[model samples]
Target: MARRPKLFEAAPGSPAETRCQLCERAVRHTSRHHLVPREEGGRYGPTVDLCQPCHSSVHLLLTNKELARRYHTVEDLQRAEELQKYLHWIRRSRVERITNRRRRR
Candidate 1:
């Protein structure tokens, strides 16, 4: 068995600083998003580290197919007009955490 490298580890003498790749904000909490989902045959691709609000917003706003097909890169996500507006609001709001409400089916 192989071990996965730590993605959030800081240098020996420094504290770990996690930042949202899309919103470009320094966050104390973050979630890792695979650019292409593992279920979508993205076994080994890029991962975007995002704050909770950004991470939740991605899933809330886009489907997995969309994530895999279109918003699969940091640049792709940042350039989205819809997300740009959302990012602006979140930045002004200065929220550090977000809780996703259960979707009604």
Candidate 2:
């Protein structure tokens, strides 16, 4: 099977840091999330730079079809009840990056 290309790749000498559009935090690495997924015939629309945790939470909480149908914007995503809860809790996190490791609390 062919490997999928990365969603967003930095230019040769682009800035190293970028702000996460969701939680308003600084992140060294970001993932690109399409508001309308390619599978849903959404080619061009809004996309956001999200930190790993935010990106994971989105997929965990909503289906791609749901994202394309209802939450197709950053504001829409922020308004999601589950996403709001995650964002609220994440706000107090001192860690810059959130990984797949399960937290004790």
Candidate 3:
């Protein structure tokens, strides 16, 4: 028999959070992230589902040029030295959503 999806893994009508490709956490909310930036001619490129904090961290740490040139794949992003510290901390935390934050203009 096929394995059943866990509680948050299954969303009836809406797309569930599933697993974050980066931190490997199952968040209640997730966003699709393009490996190659959409603005950098990757509008139709590959994407991975990332949790809110992981997704936000990616943008906060890297620029579109860096993403397009270096960290365009999940494996590459995971090995990024800049994200090591944040990843280590987030992996041990239970908080799904990062509370305090600022929006980039």
Per-candidate Cα lDDT values, in order, are: 0.76, 0.76, 0.83
lDDT of 3 at 90: 85
> Which digits, one per residue and each the tens of the lDDT, describe model 3 over residues 12-85?
44565467889987667778999999999999999999988898888888888899999999999999998999
Per-residue lDDT of candidate 1, residues 1-105 (tens digit): 997533343344455666678887666677888998888877788897888889888877877788898988989988876687888887666577667533445
Q: What is the lDDT of residue 33 in candidate 1?
A: 89
Top candidate by lDDT: 3
Worst 10 residues of 2 by lDDT: 4-13
What is the lDDT, from 0 to 100, of the residue 95 in candidate 1? 73
RMSD of each: 8.0, 8.2, 8.0
What is the model-wide C-alpha lDDT for candidate 3?
Answer: 0.83
Q: Model 2, stretches more than 4 Å misplaced?
A: 1-15, 96-105
Error of 2 at 23 (Å): 0.9
Q: TM-score of the candidate numbered 1?
A: 0.76
What TM-score fits each model?
0.76, 0.72, 0.78
